[model samples]
Target: MRTEWSEFRESLRRWIYFRKVRFKRFLKARRAKQEDRLAKRNAPTLIPEGANIRQRADPRQSKIKRLRADFSNDLEETRFRFKQWKHFRWMRVRHFFQAVRTRLADMPSIIGFFKYLLHKRQRSIREQESLSTRKMEAKASSWSKFRSIYLPEWLRRWTIGGKPKSVLLAFLLLTSLVFVLAAYPAYGLLKALRAEQLLENSRELHQKGDLQGAFRKAHASYMLNSETLETFRWLCETAESINYHELLSWRQRLADHPDSGPQDRIKLVRTALDFHQPQVAEEAIRNLREQEVEPSEYLYLRLLTTLAHGRPAKNAAIRQCREILSLPAPPLEAYRIYWSLCLDSMDPRFGREAVNHMKQTAAASGAVGLAALRTLLQLPFEDEKKQRLYSKMLWEHPLAQRHDLLLSLRAVFFGHSLPETALRAALGKQYDRLDNTELQEVTSILNNLGFHENATDLLPTRTMASNKELWVEGLRARIGSDETKETEKVLMEQTPFTESERRFLHSLLLRKNKEFKKADEELVEALRMATASDLPILRKFVLLHEDKATLVALLHRLAKEPAMQRWAQALLILTLQRGAEDEPLEELLGAIQANDYRNNPETANRITRLKVLHGQDLVACRKIAEGLVARYPDVREYRFTLALCYQESDRPVESLRLLEGMLSANPSECPTQRLIGARALLRNGFSSEARELVVGFEKINLLAAERRILDYVLTQTKAKQKGPVLP
Candidate 1:
């Protein structure tokens, strides 16, 4: 009964579904006909009406009439078309029932038909399932392939090698075979790379001018591979040369010296002096003296004299020399003492004395050297007649015959004609005829005496000559005085000196022709070049010669360079020094007083100096002093300078207060501080404080003047019973 109910429900659902589909088709057919007939009926006509203004109909009425006509035609067409479709649908329903009745009578055919339908449905389902399964299987196969391609070795081995022992062994054997096949090529490539590296090293050595090293390296590379010689060239040069390593070993042995003995130190010192390391030579002599061993007499004396003049020790060099000379030894070291006196003494008398002593020594030994005596005679004397005579003798001496003496004679006796032949004979007297410094002096003298043409002819053009300023001045004179334009032609043709020297040249040119603006610009440009080198001191010098407004702008520019900050500091100090008595300096002092960055002790001191010069009132001065002392406790001068400021302001009481504090803490520091303190206290009528400060000075040794001042202050204070004369 339940199966029969399900079958009847199925039949009812199909019947209702088919009938609803047929009804919808019928309604659509009727609506399409109505629309077509309405379109035909509303078609426009070709007939025309008479053009009478009175015959026009109302627009609303005409529209209503046309819509009614269209509605009537639609009604008629829809009714006729609906009847025709109704007849056709009735016949279709009649044929459908007749077919159903025939199917129901043949029960076996119906069952077989249903079975065939079921089989077709089952076959379709199976085909669809098979398609989906194949798609899923393909996706799984693709995933397995991707996992093998990108996964790590451990995972791949775990996944694939789990299959069988024989397969795993085969995989390992194949991997080993591949690695073995690649190893020989890798090893050969590494060997080739090493050989190329060695060849590169050899080439680098050759480029560095180490030709022998390059050759040895090349040969070593060739030993690795004979074919390397075809590419390398260093091997040829290294064939018969000594190896660098052997030479290096020999050098090392020469350098492996123990501490030098006294004689060795003396030799080293003399050698260092010859090499122009006077400071090092002096150090070496000191070391020799420390060893307490005697050097050769000549060498010892020479070291002592060079040390005295060139590189004096912390103590007085002359005193040290005199001590060395006083030693009781052979020849008595008097020759060294005499020569030192000649070099450093302000008189030629010592030079004469040196000559006398050397003569005595040489006479005692009968081998008195003309070199030492001639050196003494050549020394310039303060007395002109004596200098001329000595110069003449030096020029005439056989061994001491020097062009320097002839030039010196001419310079000393300017405007006095030397024999023209003698001057012509000394024509080629370049500076090499004299020592370095003497050459500089001669060039300067010659250029100063309007003898530049002669000086230029005498001086070398190849080497760095002395007296650059003189040369520049000579050029300017020629440009100013000479009419041939020779100097101007030379200037245009010649290369100019560096910025500083060129600046000097331009200054001379400007001074000669009175071209101030052009000269200033040239100097400014030189200054700019020097400033670019970050030399602040040079910038300051340039600013000093410039206008104040220009100087301010230059200082602003210089402030950008870190090196010029020191220059700015120095300029500030100098400006303060020059303008300390001015109102503007007081304003600057005020600004300094208000400054928070008092960490610069020099700026602080400069402020104090300006304050003292400005003569600030006692109150203003004390505040600044207290602030500075609080900020910079170690600045003892601030306190002392502050005391002077107070004393200058007629406030002896405040001055005494400042100085008393300084004297209490630093009694032994500045003797002047104590003296100022005693004087200030006694003047302010604080006799007790003055006496106390005076007693403290007795503990430390004071100069006679300081003691006298203190004594006068004490005597005056006692005599005045009430107070020192206060303002």
Candidate 2:
């Protein structure tokens, strides 16, 4: 029943679909007929003609017969037209050939006419040339007759021999000689002047620390004036910072100069030593003694060369160094060697003597004190003797009248504390004022030592108001602060600083606000305008800024610069360091390593921090820290890091000794230093000392966080003292 119902439904559906199709077709035919009738109604002009819609055709044979007769008439007309066209074409061709034959018959006459015209023109040109030639002949004859007949024979002899006269030749030769002589000296005078100018420019460049530019100018100057010791000295100084072989070539030039004196030779030897060319220094010293250099100068050079080349100085050498130091006005280098000898021999007398001499010398730039501090830096923390000496020297730095400013800097560098008020007063003590130069001397020392806040404080009141550099430096030193008055004043012309420089300082302000895009754009402009001198200043901005976004922009700008590409790779690592995120730093380093990324102190420190933070590569971390400490002894952070590395390496004694130096250098950070120090001491089983060290902090005021560290140190020391045993 279900199948039968389905078939019935299908049959009904098919019948209904066909009926609808047929109904639609019928409506279409009716609509077409209605449209045709409407067309005839609208026209009403010959309605029957519109209704027919086509010409009528008869079915009878009469209509076919009429059509055939008309077709025959059309064919007869076409044949007649074709015959006429064929006849016309033959007549046209015959006329064209007749015209060509007529023209060919006239060709001989046309050629004769053209030849006649050409001969006529040639005859006219010849007639004109002959007339002009006769006039010239007449003029030449008349001039010759006047000279030979009217002038005296003696005068004619003189005129004939004019160019070859002996007296005239001698005078001409003398004039040529004068010009040659005068011109050579003039050329040399001008060249010498230009060379002197270039030398001055090179001197300024070297002072500005643009080694490549300095060398370029110096090389040009030397090419012009190689005979001068001054030019050679400048060239050597500039090239010493760059290529060593080039420096040696210039050093040889200096030594080979005719005017090179003993002082010049000694300067060469010193430069060679500075360039790490001991063989050059050795060769120089060997020849210097015979040049009658002062005995003391020779001895100091020998000792300096020996010490610089990793060779130990003998007792004889030490005695000779003492004699040099004892001179009325010894060389500055002797005191440095004295510090070295003092460290090697463990002699306190030598140390005290060197210290006293550095204190008394009013002209000293604090080199001896720095040298002493650096020597102590190289010793291991396990060497208690060096540790005690370093502390005593670092703390007891006597601020003599001359050494006040520089020694404070060294003190700050070693993490030694100086009273802000005292340092400010001392800076203004002389001349009852401070200039940017002196302020810079102190500020640079402090900033390079990582005592940036102290550097900011030391800027004199209202000093940045009148000083553009001091203002910009203050802005840099005051990173991450709310201070903008000086920045605004400089930009708005509310201060005496220059407009051009203050505009550059806008980048630091932007960096402080974390507007890295504007900061990077401004830095890019500065880089475009940056001379070699401006670049060192610009790189410091990248080093100071910490944002990943800021560094990313800097990396793009620097990467496009071929000279700064290596720096770009280093900055790439520095950028990853900011987020401290998902990407592994080691993998990034390995990828950058393929690009030949050179290590700088800044990038090395960043990598070391990342390694330590991730708890990876403990050995490499310590080694890098050691290098950083050695390279930047003034940076207290590197020293502290190195101390931590020592602790990690199980050298607790070394760690404590290292911490002790920082503890003395920065005693104001008492709680923090003492905490780390006590822990290291406790780690080494010096629990009693650690306890006393923590107890001593009771006299100092500490912040809450510092107090927590104090309590923690106390707890650790107590735990170590009691062990797991019951009291």
Candidate 3:
């Protein structure tokens, strides 16, 4: 044990010695580096041989020396001026004291002369006072004699000679004038009071959901006091609650009123813009410009006017918008205008910068920020960074509503690589706040996007669970699920299903289960309980069934519904063409033409297809196809249809020409168009070109029908390749 301990201690000592030596080496190296740095920093400055050292000194140092010398000279001059000013001040003080001494020397004589003159003036004043008293007594006596001789008794008794009755009559006349002057204000006060009362009643009615009563009261209040902006706002709000037409009328009324203030007119213009009534907005803005308005308000109206003019005045609008936004603290409307102009430009960079500016500015906490966020969602952002930044801003915005967040999430979902889990969570939170109708819409959108589980999880846990309409939608979603059989069974066993709705649900489930006869029976029962509005539901059932009799019966049944008559007739035409029932289809077309419904593009297109399919009136079908091609030159389907029409009309040259144009325009029509084009080429007696066109089409995964068509074309080309057969 002692030997082991000795060995361990020796090893420890060796390790300690090695560490010390390494530490010493490191310290020596650090010291050497410091010394080398100091030596390099203090290296001698290079100088030309025989050069003047003073002249070659640093320019900065020389400038500093010159500044110091100039400052010293300025200090000396300042001190010298101070001394000269003090001497001048002392001399002025001496002169002031000398003048005072001279005045003191002349004071006694001046006082004695003044005393002698004062005694003489007092004696003269005494003599004049006695004469003035005697003159006054003589004048008074003469006036008394004159009054006694000229005055009459009737003049002494007149109202001007102190009669209280005339005084009272004059006072009453002045009082009457005052009352007349105040009467207008008194009437205005009474009307204003009435308007206030009416507005209060309107509020009460609005709260009670009596929108019509609220509208009447609010309109009455506005008529009573048209000058009050609040009354006008209440009127517009009430009208909007009642109906769109009413709101429009109120907006026009307020805009046309001569007495409306700037606020009223501005609100009118804003509401018109919001409702996309640009004409009304323009008229309101024109009237506002004609009236007196503040500078900011005038600028705001100008921005609105420029925006209403659209792209024609975009440059001017952008300049004015930038100027307004450059103000120290511009109004929220200025930010709104900036964003509007940005959106109009459709420049994603401008949108991104404007959104960033809005986020940093005080406008981000208010309606301006909300508008910016909404606009940001509409902008086509190309960068994922900007999209994520905008998403973060929207998520953290204090004023963002559930709808706003959901829209932001949707924007991010489409524009960025945000996690689906995060999007689902945000949508789920908003789902809880949405009303029944909004929930239904959001759920449908989710289902359509294939987020079935997320949509099912987002269902409302409260009143919506008991909502019959929502329950039906949920069942439909389940029926569309992968586990349709199980979901259908669950739906069948559920309680609270209406008889008509149960029949409808059962029909859908039966159809999914391939029990068509039972499904048709259920559908008929459901149709019996259905209303005119249920035509869409019945149409879905018709589309599911392949039986010509079932489709015709459904169409005939739907024809009785006035709202569904036209739709039913269109569907009947499609059904007849599908079944190749030429006579019935022609008769239906004649009836439709008699009704002038065939003039519609949809009906005309359908009729053209029917003629093409039935091989009847190929010339007329070609004419219709030509018109379709002319009307929709860019639509490939129209062009293809025209090609088909040409092919069937025995105009294979024209058909091949159209097909060649289609292929040249887009060669990616690898299988379908090439097959058709090859057939057209073969029909046009170009067997070699046709063989080359479809040489490799079989390598593609062609459908059985496509393969058969290709095989027939190839067989014809091969048969023609051999020499003519001997008879």
Best candidate (score: lDDT): 3
Select the stronger candidate by TM-score from 1 and 2: 2
Give stretches of model 1 more than 4 Å off: 1-259, 263-292, 295-315, 324-384, 415-419, 427-453, 456-489, 494-504, 512-518, 530-727
Best by TM-score: 3
In what order do the candidates fall by TM-score, top score first? 3, 2, 1
lDDT per residue for candidate 3 within 276-358, as digits (tens), equals 55557667767765456766677776677556544434556778888877766667777776766665443343555665665
Residue-by-residue lDDT tens digits, candidate 2, 1-727: 9999999999999999999999998997677667656654574343364466564433324433555789999999999999999999999999999999999999999999999999999999979866765665566676664565435444445556556678677767887999999999999999999999998998898889888898999899989987776777777777778865666666677787777777767877887776656667778887775558766777788877655523223344567777787667677678666656655543344555544454454233465555555444444456555455554454445633333343434433345445656555445565246567877666666555455677677676453656645655665655523465555443565654333233446676777677778877876676555544444445565655565554565565566667777757666665655343325456655444221311334445555644544456778778778876665465555556676667667787787666655443433232444565666767766666667657767666544434554676677665646432111
Query: RMSD (Cα, Å) of candidate 2?
Result: 26.1
Query: Where does candidate 3 have its weakest 10-residue lDDT segment?
Result: 593-602
lDDT rank, highest first?
3, 2, 1
Clashing pairs in 2: 415-665
Candidate 1 lDDT tens digits, 1-727? 9999999999999999999999998887676667666754685543456556455343333344566789999999999999999999999999999999887888888799899999999999979966765665566766664564334435556556347887777777888999989997898777777777787898798878877777767767766665543433334334324333333222222222353234445545544444434445545555445335543454454534344332212123344444555565534344544465556443343456555655454323211244444444445445777556555544555554344545545545555545545654553454346654555555555554445555555444435344454444445335434422454444444433555545634543553466778866765675566545434334423432334534543554564577555446446544534432244445545554523323344454555545554554445656666775664354456667667666666877777666555554535334555567767767766666566656655566543444566777778766546543323
lDDT of each: 0.54, 0.62, 0.67
lDDT of 2: 0.62
Q: Name the 10 consecutive residues with the lowest summed lDDT in model 2.
A: 592-601
